[model samples]
Target chain A: MAFLKLESLRKAYGEFVAVKECSLSIGEGEFVCLLGPSGCGKTTTLQMIAGFVEPTEGRIILNGADITRLGPSKRGLGIVFQSYALFPHMTVAANVAFGLEMRAIAKRERRERVAHMLDLVRLDGFADRYPRQLSGGQRQRVALARALVIEPSVLLLDEPMGALDALLREEMQIELRALQKRLGITTIMVTHDQVEAMSLADRVVLLNNGSVEQVAEPFAMYEHPSGRFASTFLGKSNVLAGDVSGASVLVGDQELPADLAGMSGAVDYIIRPEKITFAAAGGLVRGQVTARVFLGDRWLYQLDTPVGPMQVIDTNVGLPKAVEGDAVGLVWAAENARVVARGAAS
Target chain B: MSRTPIALHIFHWLFVLFMVAPLAVVVLVSFTDKGYISFPFDGASLRWFQAIWNQKSFIDSFWLSLALGATAATLAVVLAVPAAMAIAWHRFPARDLALALLMSPLMLPAIVLGIAILRLLSHLGMTGSLAGLVAAHMVVVLPYVLRLVIAAAAGYDHALSQAARSLGASAWAAFRRIELPQLVPGIAGGWIIAFVTSFDELTMSIFVSSAGTTTLPVRMYNYIANTIDPLLAAISTVLIALTLVLMIVLDRLFGLDRILGGKA
Candidate 1:
């Protein structure tokens, strides 16, 4: 059974539709991420679920109860804002104890629970410090502890790691994921960073123009994006416009094998950079390397091909397989390429 | 860092001296033994300071002014906090107009406001009442309080309130525990500013005050009009000291630089 359900939710501010009939059912203890670029309604959808923004139409059911009209205070959900939003005037212990205090929990239990939460977040000895005195990562941990202390049914995080540096963000991501799983709490996080979503979430919901484009496991969504927007937004893709005919896509007179399933007309042949391999000869498409960028663990090669410009990523084991101005053929399995209908969402 | 030029530094000192000269002269004249307002003291004496204790009206007015300023400032802050929150947090129709109307007293000339308020109070039979005086002072000090509170509220992280609410805090609880505590610097600064402004106000108090409800500044003004003596200078010196103490207190509690620089 679904633990939470957003049923045909739509939010419109006059003529502008912020979230257009987005629907999803999340399983118990599921970690879902609403992933998209800015203004893609990902944040709006998260806000609706958090009960901060009321939907113009539709219902939100939580734990088999219709909570569509419930106010945020009664939602019983934990939330960590992008800015952390830790109470600057309160000590770390007091900040975490706030939720329990609001619930009218007794003083001794509040203290014990708050202490335990501080330990859980590894902020045990820093309980008396104020938010301003703590570093960025420490403050984030305080926010997380504060939210989780209430033992809420679901935890909502809005760009939780956006404020942290890259290294700290990665560290926090692992810690947050472990904490969520250990607690077995349902989690919904909103992020524009695809890498963060891919690494952190159990399921990634790709949204565009106020609608869900695709919702699948991170690997599945990345491997088989449903449309043009999903294919490009999640990661870089070398999309070649081609004509579909006889189980093949013809790009600038260069035929490439594809699974069109008898569908005809214009289509976009999408292939990830890492999936394409360099060949000396007899490959799908012949291309000349235009530029090569060394990315520590990988070498990203830009190439000019018969169809259009293509990007290919070769793993950095020893030396680069190809250099700038080198002529090479690019090869990829037909199953690895995604054939999306053209002109739907470019 | 670049050094300030000697010419500019001299000009700055001259400007400071120009501002402090009159106050220094008042302090110096307060110690004079002469009966009149003569500059360059004959000899130092504390008799004029002793004379302030003999004047019952000055003492009474001083206490009355303290009560009036404290009461008026508290009332202004109580009203302004909610008013500022509404203006800063909501998008109601006429929000800007409401702010303008509330802050309109700052734009109007004080003497004009005094006359207008005097006319209205007399009609309401509250012309000489303490309530009327406090009402008038609240009008004068509310804008200062509201401006600071609004700035603080504007800079406030609204997400904090939402976070509190989502963590099972009721709206009132969130406001009381989270929002109000964060706004302490603004509220404290506004209250202090309002108190000082109301205490030092002269023009509006002159028109609105009765003999029974006279303020310290009005009493001082009346004494100056009747007799130009060193006793007046002594009272001014005492006020300067009190004001200096209040400034120190304000700075210690909430850094004056930060509050005045509008960071809160």
Candidate 2:
């Protein structure tokens, strides 16, 4: 058994299901991110583990104990909320010491531990400052320190950096990842940002419409997504609809090579935008550049191909670039294209 | 206090004068040795203050009003905190109706509420009792409780309690530690509002109280009806001073300056 286990956990309100039949296992000290779009039940799933949301079915196990029926306080999971949720009236040190105070820890030890945790989050010398007096990033650090001070079994973060601006958020992500490793506490974070998940998690679980779509390592999830929804949600993709034939798929009167020697039927395939490279001469197919976007480090092109509208991303390292309305050929290794079974969601 | 046109400034001061000049006249008259209300350029004395102080009926009525105000406001807060939190934080069947009913007392006629409470108290065989009076005043002041507490609870992030719980604080502990401190200012504001409303209440108190249980407002109302003396002025002046002291203390505790014009 893993350190923490969720077995077919589910949650429903009236006739509507917010989370349905989710299961996962986490090893000791592993970092996991529940990645999904809004209303995808990721937060609900985390809440169930935190013992805030009652699961409609299944059991949650932690360290050989079944905690499915336990209350949130009994579960002893530390959670950093999306809004940070620091107590406005409490000073930074008091906020960090609250859980210890609740547990009736000795006052002297509690003070020492609070100071230690504050220093860990790089919030030294800010013990007496109230939350309102601190900036956004400072408040977030205080929240993290407060949650971690209790030495919880599992640290649950609900969009921990959602309130920060883009630059601060990116900075905090790297800093938080380093802090988590230093503590070596089991962690699960919920985020809608794919880059955050990819940058932080040892494993990512993608949720959609209250169901688990895919669960894999971040790199595996990006390179080998299990289905169409997972592929499109994780990164930009060009989905091609075609018929499987002998050694190739017939895509819009052109043969796109695939390992379909025995397969014969309609299929959908996903090619990541970055996988398709711009070519000067003949390649897999030709398309007209409908749009071009100059991202800081890369150029992204939207191509109107014979098969469908496709997107190709290229490194902006002085590579040959195509402008909008320019005709270009795109190619990639045959194995880079993936065949995906479509789910009901778009 | 923001900058405004001279005309608007004049209008603002005139409005203040219109509202406060009557109370100012009462204060001025109470300090005079004159037997009746007369204000301009009179010799001042503390004789009326000593007279009201010596009156057993006014003294009893004053203590009765204070006790009633304190109990009613405290009870209103006790009843309203959880109810307001539920109404503010949770979605349930009849939530709108529940809020509407809780807030309806603010709009309902005081005489109607008084009569309703009178009938209820009479039916319960507890008319004119201090306990019955407190209950009635709680009902009267409940709208203030709900309004202030709901506003405070809605502004508060409900997730703080959840975070506290996830940090191993039990429900009551979470409430006492995290939620209560955050609510102190709102509770203080609500208590002051409720106490003031209950202290000045006369529409219901006259109907509910017996001769022994008469409140200051009820006694003062009777005195003004039967006599024309500066004694009424003295009582009003005392109540006004008490209110001013309370407002000053509240301002010190909770910054009423921000309440007045912080937004503008």
TM per model?
A: 0.97, 0.93
In model 1, the Cα lDDT at residue A121 comes to: 96
TM-score of chain A of 2: 0.96
- Say which docking band candidate 1 falls in: high
Q: Write the per-residue lDDT of candidate 2 for residues A181-298, one digit (tens) a residue.
A: 9989999999999999999999999999898888999989998887678888998887888777677777789788765435567777778999888887788899999988889899
The C-alpha lDDT values of all candidates are 0.92, 0.87
Taking the candidates in order, what DockQ does each have? 0.89, 0.81
Which portions of model 2 show Cα errors greater than 4 Å?
Answer: A260-264, A341-346, B1-3, B39-46, B93-108, B257-264
lDDT of 1 at A44: 88
Every prediction: chain A TM-score: 0.98, 0.96
Worst 10 residues of 1 chain A by lDDT: A337-346
Over the stretch B3-57, how does candidate 2's per-residue lDDT look in tens digits? 7899999999999999999999888888988877776745889899988978889
